[model samples]
Target chain A: MTLFDSLAIAWTALRSNLLRSILTTLGIIIGVASVIILVSVGSGARVEVEKQIASLGSNMLVVFSGSSRGMGGRSAGAGTDLPIAEGDVAAIRDKVQGVIAISGQLNGSGPVVNGNTNWTTTLSGVHPDFATVRDWPVRAGRDFTPQDIRASAKVVILGQTAVKQLFQDEDPIGATIRVKSAPFQVIGVLAPKGQSAMGRDQDDVALIPMTTARGYIVGKSQVQSDQVGQLYIKFDNSTDLKDAQEQIETLLRQRRRIQPGAEDNFNVRNLAETMKARTEVLSTMTYLLAATSVISLIVGGIGIMNIMLVSVTERTREIGLRLAVGARQRDIMRQFLVEAVTLCLIGGLIGIALGVGAAAIVANAADWPVVISPAVIALAMAAAAGTGIVFGYFPARRASGLNPIEALRSE
Target chain B: MNSVAAIIEASQVSAPVAPQSAAPALIRASGVSKIYRMGDQTVRALDDVSLEIAKGDFVAIMGASGSGKSTMMNLIGALDRPTTGHLAIDGRDIATMSSDELADLRNGTIGFVFQQFNLLPRTPALNQVILPLLYAHPRPDDLEARAHHRLEQVGLGKRTDHLPSQLSGGQQQRVAIARALINNPKILLADEPTGALDTKTSEEIMKLFGELNAEGITVIIVTHEPDIADFARRKLVFRDGKIIDDTERAPLKAATAAKDRVL
Candidate 1:
């Protein structure tokens, strides 16, 4: 018989026992739905982490001077490494082939005064390339030119949060604000960036030329090491990040003359790597949930097998009748197998619809992005069919192996 | 012409024996026995039985409960293999044919009707009749027409949409008969076909069988009731796993029997 004909017959049988058929597929429904939800949630988390990390910066590396010890786990204390100077920055910029931009930074924080308002925020002294390296474009006024860095001009760029607190409704560009009684002219307003992974507001900061901060804001140490606290390096793209990071680290080590056996006083951190670690943690959680889903799938298959065995027993006389009418053993076997596959496929389709719907509702509620690709759908379908075959085979074989004489006599 | 001679003269149902030669038997059994192993002991269902049924002949087998009549029917139906002898239907050796071949023999050559009608529950009459044809390869395009024709032959054409639960016992039996005839088998095997029907319905069913037999289909019925067996031209009675009596008589006309029911 044609597969379509067999499927039609199987469908009729299922419809005749509609309630039993539906109950039989409940296990499959729950199994398939849970699997789909787990996969979507995992991918959603990865995407979320990538987004948060991308906001921090893409294809970017932060080079921290001194040992890796801090309140936040990465940033180094100022004046801790005297050997990491502006010359090491120049060497990395010149030697690293994937380098897109690089900047030197010296940092401190203090209260900024404007008219009657005063707000405390981070103050960072950086070269002209700092804003572009961090993907922090200025929103208004004008960028501080290279001449400003060379001449130690007291021009400053205000972050969005700092502007909001210090200026309120007024345009602060070209306005002068005092940092610890030292007057600084606001050259531009930095664009707004949201919170960091650590829940810190990223926009609560100010940027000024490194020369000005070294001389006036955060006065230079007496050793005259020309030391900048950190360096930010941007690569061409994410693909080049690893290679560029390695090149920068090697160039810095060579310029600083650090021995191979000694632990270097600098640490190069890839922002994407840290984000990937968080993604791995999320993926582990997904696997744990997926494992539970798999157990349910097997349990569902067992249910199908149990019900199919019972069906074969219940329809023993029917099997005999078909056999008497010249249906081959294979035909009897195919009939039951088709019934199982039909049940699973229908249940799987419903599960997929339910999973997608649930994922969409949950994602929207939690403010997460969910991707439902065709591949995942196909996998679910294949899994359902496979489950049918694996579980249905035994019962089908039992039915086909029945002696017609004996079967006909079964009540 | 004698009744036997007349039957031999007009036979067109099965086998390819020369007209000038004696007609080869449609069913031939030689010393066929069926033994059942129940636990450690054995029970002989049939023993050393030999018989020949010519094509287009209507025969009735009668016996008590332990007389092996049902066992004989099962063997004739090809539902079981003989223990130590040979049985052949349509000139093919049943002893040597594989299970698949036996199934084909049953499918193409024999039709079976049970006492209970055995119509699938909740299935409409038309689909129940179409079950046999589904297994026929190179499936005929006129399947629905064939099923309808058989239902019409059995006088159930108007109730083709009725389920077994909705039909009377007689109507259900008619439906089963239509299903059996749908494949146009050479022989019809009815086991106590009238056992479950009332007298009037039993007469009606026998009348239908009589009509089919007149159309050149061989008919074999296994019944304990002598009145039901009276409709067949030949009769065999079994006792103690053996045929103890065999007789031939002019069959009772079903029309007269139906008329007698009113009187």
Candidate 2:
């Protein structure tokens, strides 16, 4: 038979029992839809992670004190001997080639009071370049100048949440706020930066010049400074992050006077490591969910096979008539196979629409960043068609191989 | 009267001796046997039986149940291979022909009508008639036109759109006949073609067969009914897997009139 005739025969046979055909394709539909939705969710999570990473400064690296031994030997709290001071930051700026900015931070928590309203928040003492390294934008007033740190001027920058709690509708940039009985003029109010994926509030803090903070708040001299908690380094570009990190690590070890073969005294952290960890966790979760969806698809394929077997039994006489009319065994097989594939393709189409729609709804509800690629759509369609061909083969073969006379004799 | 006797004598002498090999016989069988093995027992359906059918000759085989007349028809129709004999349809030996060649021969030369009518249910008359042509012809347009012409010839022109289920028993049998004739086969085989119809419908079907035979199409009908067998010019009676008697019917002008009226 010609290709058109074969298609006509297959079409007629499928149309003969519309309900059964639809039911047979339900498996492929669910399978295709599940694959699409699961993959979308996975990619959506990856995009979310990248956004959070972008929020933490694009070219910035974080450095904190580590144990004398390797990781897991001791916590940062256990290591009072490893002190990262302002001198190491100056040495790194002078030695490194791609270093753009470097700052040492001392963190302390206390009540920040303005008039009668007081809110507890972290106070970070940083240099003038700290705003440039950490992507901190000043929304109102002005950032601290180098002169403010040199002269130990009593000026502070309030974060968005701190300003909201203390000043309400009023501009708090030029107002005076006391940190533990030391009054300082507000130099600026920083832009809002929302919460991180780890659920830490990013905007509930205050910034002050390192000299002023050390002199008045923490009460330590430059020579006897012992409370430097963290060091923040920024690269000219992300491409230089590794080179800058390696140079700084060497400099800090030499300056701290660690001997050869001694364990490192500090940890180097960058955006790349955080991004990798987040991607790995997200990918594993996506695969697990996708695998569960595939189970339903397999169940759908079984449903198609079972219905096809029933169809073969029901159409025994028709098969006999076709055999009698000089139809080849392969011809019979092809006709049924085409019918099966067509059923699945229809189901696959419906499933694709449902999956995309569901993903869109979820994305809207959770405010997620979702991208539905054309390649994923095509793959889903191909997988659905394969399901039909694989599951529809055995029943078609059985029908084709039936004895003509015996089939005719069957009631 | 003298010529009739002389012709009869000539035929009698020629029957004992096989005819000369120059003329191509439409169907030839020599020592043909069909054995049906049921469990451990073997039934000799046709035991060393031989027969020959010439082109453009209408013949009927009559027998009781289990007489193996249907088995002989199957071998002649190329639907079955003889177990221990040389059986040929037209010039091709059944045993030597491949399955595809047999199918081709069946498509081009042999047409079959069954007692059950065997019309596909829920199918239009035109589609039923066009089915055999689909296997025979390459051009779909020509097949459709030929199918329509055949259905019209069988007096089902207006009923072409009606399904087999909607047609009467006699009409359904006519549709089967139309289907058989669609391929324009050289030989037509009917196995009790009118057995399921009433007396009047049976007569009409027999008359239609007679008309078809008169149109130069070789026709064979298998029937046990004497009245049905009487319509054929030549008849053979089967008994216990063997042809025991072969006879020619008396010349009847009434048969011609009945056939002409049906056509």
Candidate 3:
């Protein structure tokens, strides 16, 4: 028989037992749908992490002061070593080839008052360029000027949370707020920055000129004269951030007079690198889910084989009639094989629709971004056909091997 | 031979019949025996039987159940190979033929009809007749037209669109006959073609077989009813795997009787 005729015959047989065909396809549908859905969610998480990394700062690096060495020889928490000095910051700023911007900050918390209302909030002492290095654009008024930093003027920038708490419905610009009983003029309000990966409200702090805080707000320093606790640096967009971070670290080592082969006292943290690491983690999780779902696909394949076996047994007489009518063994084999592949293809099509629908629903319900790629659809379809061939062969061979006399006599 | 002589004497049936032709037999079976093994036991279904059926011959094999008549029918139909000895069709020895070759022979040279009509369910009459042609070597290009022609030839021209379930028992048998003739084979082997029909329908089916034989196709029927056997020019009787009687006589006028009642 022609291949077309064989396929037509296979379709007719499947149509005759509609309920059985549908039941056999259910397993495959579930397997493909679950695999695609899980993979999509993983991709969404990877994208979310990349966005978070970009939010922290693009092409940026944070240099922490050296950790303290205990008497027992183990390192202590960061900032225990000598704090970074203004001269060291200026040296790095002048010496690093790719250094585009530099700023220093000292962080602490205190009660700030406006009229009868008082709010306790963490405050930062920083250069005017700190806002640019951190990508924190001011929403209402102007940023602190160079003159403000040089003269150590008592000017301040309020974060969104601090503004909401102290100002209520009133405009905070040009208003006077008390910091440690010293009055500081509110210059601007930083735009709201939502939350960080650590679940902390990022917009819950204040900014002031570093020179003012060092001379008046924070009192004296123990580690060094005119030292800031942290240094923030930005590199040109086209320059590789890792290269800039390495050049900065090496310059710091030489300035600190650290011996060769000794562990560096300071640590450099790249937020982008951490985001890439999380992407790797998400990829591993997706592969694990794929493996588990492949097991389910095999189970679904087994279901197909079971149904095909039953169908062959029930149609023994029909097979004998075909054989008696001069149907070749291969013809019979191809007929059943076609039936199996048709079943899987149908199931796979339904599964693609289900998976896309599920991804959309989850995206809406959980408010998480989801992506459905063509690669996923192609993978699902190929798996379905492969499953059919691998599982359908044995039953088809059994059917082709049946003896005409015996088969006809069976009924 | 002895029983043949005895029946001839009792009926005083006409003078000894003349051989139809000098042409070689279309089917040749010599020393053929079929043995069945059911686990540890063996049953002899056909015992060293020899027979020849010439082209354009009409034959009926009659015997009760377990008398080995069905076994002989299967062997002649090329559906099974004899356990011992040789069988040939149109002078070609089938003893050494492979299963594939046997299938080809059945496809191009032999056709079979069953008692139950053996038509595929849900298929229309025209499509049913085209099934055998699908497996023919060099599969025909004009399949629908050929199937339609055969259905028309079988007097089913008016009901070609109806399913088998919509047709009468005799009509279903006619459709089966049309399927058997689709490949234009040399031999038409039928096993109890009217076993499921009423008496009047049986006569109509027997009449159809007789007409096809008259058109020069070799026809063989395996049946247990004497009245059905009356339509054949030759009758062979089997008992316990042995041919107890072989006789040939003038065929009765079954087609006329069929036309007088229902046609």
Predicted candidate 1 versus true structure: per-residue lDDT over A117-186, tens digit per residue: 8998988888888878888899999887989988989888999999999998999988999986888899
What local lDDT does model 3 show for residue A357? 95
lDDT of 1 by residue, B15-37 (tens): 22222234457888999998989
lDDT string, candidate 3, A1-411, tens digits: 888888788889889999999989888898888878988887887777776776677778888887544435787778877678788789978988777777888877788999898998877888777877888789999998989988999999999999999998899999999997899999999998776666577788888888887887776654355877688887788878778778887988898888997777886778778778888998899889977988888999999999999999999988888888888788889998888888888888888899889999999999877888889889999999988888899999999999987887777
Worst 10 residues of 2 chain A by lDDT: A219-228
Candidate 3 residue lDDT tens string, B1-263: 33322332232245235233433589889999999999999999999999888776778999989999999888787878999988998777777888888888888788888888888888899888888788878898998888788888789988888999999888999999888888888899999998999999998788888767655578899999999998887899999999999887777655354223322
lDDT of 2 by residue, A88-177 (tens): 777878987777877777777788999999999988888888777778788889988989988988899988988898999997867888
Q: Which candidate should be chosen as best, given DockQ against the real structure? A: 1
Is candidate 1 or 2 superior in TM-score? Answer: 1
Task: Estimate candidate 1's alpha-carbon lDDT, on a 0 to 1 scale.
Answer: 0.82
On TM-score, the candidate that comes out on top is 1
Models 1 onward score TM values of 0.81, 0.76, 0.76
What is candidate 2's DockQ?
Answer: 0.28
Model 3 residue B184 CA deviation (Å) reads: 2.1
Residue A105 in candidate 1, Cα distance off native in Å: 5.0
User: Once superposed on the true structure, which residue ranges of model 3 sit more than 4 Å away at CA?
Assistant: A50-61, A65-85, A91-266, B1-20, B253-263
Give the 10-residue window scoring lowest on summed lDDT in candidate 3 chain A: A216-225
**Scored by Cα lDDT, where does model 3 land?**
0.83
The deviation in Å at residue A283 for candidate 2 is 2.4
